[model samples]
Target chain A: MYEERHHSEILEDVLQFIYPLIILFGLYIILTGISQPGGGFQGGAVLVAIFMCRYLVSPREMGRLDLIQKIDKLILVFILALASMLILLGFREVIPYFNGIYNMLIGILIGIKVASGLTVIFYTFAFIEGGKED
Target chain B: MMPVVEKIMYIALIIFAFMSVQTPKLRRAVVYLAVFSAGSAFVYVLLGAPDAALAEAVIGSTIATIIFLSALQKYKAFTVYYTNEMRHEYRQSNLFRRRNAVLERIENFCSGKDLEAHIMYTTESLQEVMKNHGWDIIVRRKNNKFSIYGMEQNYHIEEMKKYIDENFNDLRKLGYEIELHIGWSENE
Candidate 1:
């Protein structure tokens, strides 16, 4: 059942070239989401492609999933806290220009949450659960 | 032209959806599902919902497919080791055909039980294979006699024993001796 890890030079090279570009694009989508069609969820999903590509490069190697899971939970709490504060403090009424900033902040937070959440799920299925069979 | 393109995308979506559901192999079904997702994403974009299209394309087509593939990889896989002692005799065309026929039957049985059959032919002796490798089934052929070895705890062994007994009667009549050694101990 133990087999040698297969390496594809072409895949490695191409992914190396596009890795930074994908990150930049995902960040761009999330940051500009307040003014554009793309938003946190979509941008976060795109960011997941980075980890997926990493998996393709090396099936056995994955970043610390527990850390990502922690980040996901922490982001969820932050999003909830921010939303409640906005509602309770009546910040929207007092500060007219705060709307755009709040939207952008929320968008960025959701994007990070979605990215980390999906990464955790993907790695769990691909490696953690699958490793038991071996 | 735009309407025609939309119609074609809609038709592709239907076809892929049906194929994903109807395909027998889990891996092929996953691919079909990915294609279905991509087709639907296109339809969404055409309908002016770029946001939904982006979500479907990334999640359904890419992430879901990868997850399904990894799950399938860890699913039930039936490994069979085939060793032939009569290396010279196995070169004969008829013996090769007979060996393939036996493997085909085993494959059919595995598919019926929703298992993927992986057959490996090795020059190593049956005893050596038993000692070194993890296997669901081992078929060792010494001339016309075939010894099938399997573990006691494997649920499929009993079913396979019945299958061979029922199906290999013709080979028995042809002077082939097929023996089933169930509950085979690893130490022995």
Candidate 2:
């Protein structure tokens, strides 16, 4: 399962500039998503594209899994809280101004959850690399 | 307008993603995952989400490949793990090579077949009552680890342990965490 890391190529510099632009475009698409066709899944998948790009060029140099994994777990908790808050606050509480804030917070929460969830896509490969020996 | 082409590309991306998941081998899976990441990144560009595409290209593909490869070298490099958890006794000794001086000295003890006669087992009175066995069990230096290979001797696990118990003064011991692998001529 362990793979050797290929040396960094000259193409990395070019890839670096390219990935961030992709992120910005994804953000814009997802933010305007309320009226647009795409929603959280598409936006998050697009967001993970940046991480994937770096992995393709030089997979060995990467080690962001621990950080991403921890965040991924937290995002799920935040998402659950947001969902619960939405149900309780929207149907039970009759505050219009608070709803707007709640929606905004939910939007932000969704972004974090989406970003974190996509890390699993990367971890499927990482699990291959992880093993203990005698 | 060629809306069909766009739909085909989306379908391809989705198929590619699932294909990555379907790969049986870890390396092949990683390769598919890389392809999936690249394909998705392209989809990102088409979807007008260039930044997300970039992230997929950078972190998803590159970093994942890197970590997986490095991990293989130390632990699971080409080590096949069966999904069926059969409790098998596997020997790690075949994969390990030692180049220690004391071990070299022990191996070079050329007096043939009976080095134990020359070896005197002494706990240094630091721990045990001295017993005189015909076999000369001589090891020096307390708390130092010793690698002893038994040739044509299938010493029982308790007997091997007794060696450590008897020779504490010059033995590096694996207390409570010791592992024993019994091998015979028929066992590889």
Candidate 3:
């Protein structure tokens, strides 16, 4: 119970800037990842994890973000699908981005996946949190 | 397989993540997120990305976490107000700032009304805004073709736009650029 309360307040506040930063951060991790560490999965997961973090951070701020959530989610899905599908298309015979140059595309897909997955988790949690008086 | 240290860091991350998940309030979750990020940073360090690790620490532990707590305060979030003034500052600041900001926005709008434009700029010539909403009306030519007479608005550009639109239209029609533009904002 304390955990929930503590996190709820914290997550809510963090979302103000964290969400945008997370997306930016994910991009940073992915784009720079090839030459360095942090490939698709970790970077992408981190991106989406931001959403979950945001959701957990600010459940009550839902009213403010209601429209944003819906529209943003739709856009996110399209982006992720497009990115992954593009990569998949490139891999007609073999996995795309055999070279590291196109690896950024893969990183993007991973980031999108991470973003969407966690967004869903948070979205559901927010729904539940809103349903009851806490 | 990841390193033992990395594995341990991962475990810490998971534990923190779970803590955030189990924690109901937003503030606690934010703090947990910070902790989780710190743990992830450790894993990153273990994996040889000290830069990423440092970033995570700064972002996760300090900046992001503080903001998250602030949001909770905004939302009447879970509380640990150890002091009255601290509680008062947290509780009142948002409301006050928002209220003032709204009023300021409105006042900015009101002030932008150019209540004295007819008196200020005659049906004159072209001028330039030095900065945002800076009204550099060329009352008189200075040091050759150089212009003068300027006023910078500290208000939303939208309000300034309305002022320009309302007061300067005649000038605009007369081929006098109002030297003012309304920016994109809530007023739009």
Candidate 4:
């Protein structure tokens, strides 16, 4: 509900310039998370920060919420199904190479799930004061 | 089992929590809360929970602060306009009379009700002040009589009217007059 600040032409240009780099870094974090310090939660948070910055700069340009919600739910169900299947198949008995592949797949799913969840929360909070759902 | 660094961190955490609650401005409080969260996140990391630390840093410092600040933007403001005589500007002859006393009273009232008080000192005519901006209360002084214009939409003015009438009515017997006007709607 904060009043929109006076927009500067330079800031928008700067954000446009650096946005791709930030997305690339976030993707790198998520993809390398299984063997690195960053993981799905951290990478998803970084990705959500992009949406936050976008809203801060231009509030009226948000896209469809239904699409985001659908993607989020789909990823969540997929993660649950995959985890349960692994458990039922006795995850400990899985070969090392297959485990690595499963780990990467699950990490990707979790990253997508987290990104969508945070996007939903941010959008809900942003528009709760009576703006359009976009 | 506490090292010097962790001991200091605990102390900082407690101090930040206290200051966050004690700050007067909502925005300042939010900033303090963010700092508190940051300190706690560091403690979590030191305690061998990087996952908790990351979640705390992201949700606590960034997103929560933004949400609180956005909510604070909708906080209703109470603005008071004090019309001063040209001479009173330079002649601080009486510090506790008229304008200052009224401002202090309003300040107390606002603090009690957790409202922000914006006091404006201007020599503009009452009509000009009312015409230009939205004001909750405008105190116009004219020949020993103070005309207080209160907007109708502000419910606080009605309670203020009762308090002022009760407390300042005795001053009317001393030859100074106080008139309360509470029916002016905005844009009219």
Candidate 4: clashing pairs of residues: none
- The number of the candidate with the highest TM-score is 1
- All DockQ scores: 0.61, 0.07, 0.03, 0.30
Worst 10 residues of 4 chain B by lDDT: B90-99
> Which parts of model 3 have CA positions greater than 4 angstroms off?
A1-22, A49-98, B1-40, B43-188
Q: What's model 1's lDDT at A84?
A: 100
Q: Can you tell me the CAPRI class of model 2?
A: incorrect
Candidate 1 residue B52 C-alpha distance from true site, Å: 0.5
DockQ-based CAPRI category assigned to the predicted complex of candidate 3: incorrect
How much does candidate 4 score in TM-score?
0.74
Q: CA lDDT of each candidate?
A: 0.87, 0.52, 0.51, 0.78
Top candidate on DockQ is 1
What residue pairs are clashing in model 1? Answer: none
> How well does candidate 1 reproduce the true complex, by DockQ?
0.61
Q: What lDDT score goes with residue A28 in model 3?
A: 78
Candidate 1 residue-pair clash tally: 0
> Rank order by TM-score, top first?
1, 4, 2, 3
TM-score of chain A of each: 0.88, 0.73, 0.52, 0.82
Worst 10 residues of 1 chain B by lDDT: B88-97
Model 3 Cα lDDT, one tens digit per residue, A1-134: 53455565544665776778877777777788778766555565566555556545544444434554565576567666766865677754475445664566666655565555545544545554435343
- lDDT tens digits by residue: candidate 1, B70-153: 788788889999898767233557645665667777888998999988888877888899889889999888888888899888
- Which model is ahead, 1 or 2, in terms of DockQ? 1
The order of the candidates by DockQ, greatest first, is: 1, 4, 2, 3
TM-score of each: 0.77, 0.39, 0.34, 0.74
Once model 1 is optimally superposed onto the true structure by TM-score, how far is the C-alpha of residue B9 displaced, in angstroms? Answer: 2.4
